[model samples]
Target: MTPESARALAEDYFNGGRPHPLDIGVYTFDAGYVAWPREPTPGDPTVLPDTVGGACIVIDRHTGEVSVRPLLPPELVAELWPDPTPR
Candidate 1:
């Protein structure tokens, strides 16, 4: 899938039933996309309690399937797409 499509899927997954007011940010990689909740105001000291330790949303480029993984660096998460670690 294209980056745009992958980002859309990730955003949908990230925002679905999310209790935080933060917006979702997406990064594209060769394998697919990584999405996570981001602070609406960068450098703001206030933290959205619900966003803490939220899972990273991964969207497969080929299958377009969404998976939840522990919060990790976006690049590392992308490199480990289809991570073997049990969810």
Candidate 2:
């Protein structure tokens, strides 16, 4: 999923606006998620769907608080929250 579409979905369905789901295969990282719509195609279903996107906030595994944006670029993610270990 492209970052653009992910951002759009974040603004749209993050707060029960679209029944957003917050977990995925090997990537359960938050309290919100959006299942998204399936695309029409003629291929294997094992391949994960595209466009279905949402946001996840990285938190301290122990503290359980918002730490970083998670899965985002360092700069952008850092903007949301400071790096646990900075230079």
TM-scores, all candidates, are: 0.71, 0.26
Best-fitting candidate, scored by lDDT? 1
Across residues 1-87, which tens digit of lDDT does each residue of candidate 2 receive? 333444344444434445754333122223322223223563887888674543444433334344323344434444444444434
List pairs with backbone clashes in candidate 1: none
Q: Which has the greatest TM-score? A: 1
Q: Which residue segments of model 1 deviate by more than 4 Å?
A: 17-21, 42-50
lDDT of 1 at 22: 53
Q: What is the lDDT of candidate 2?
A: 0.39
What lDDT does each candidate get?
0.74, 0.39
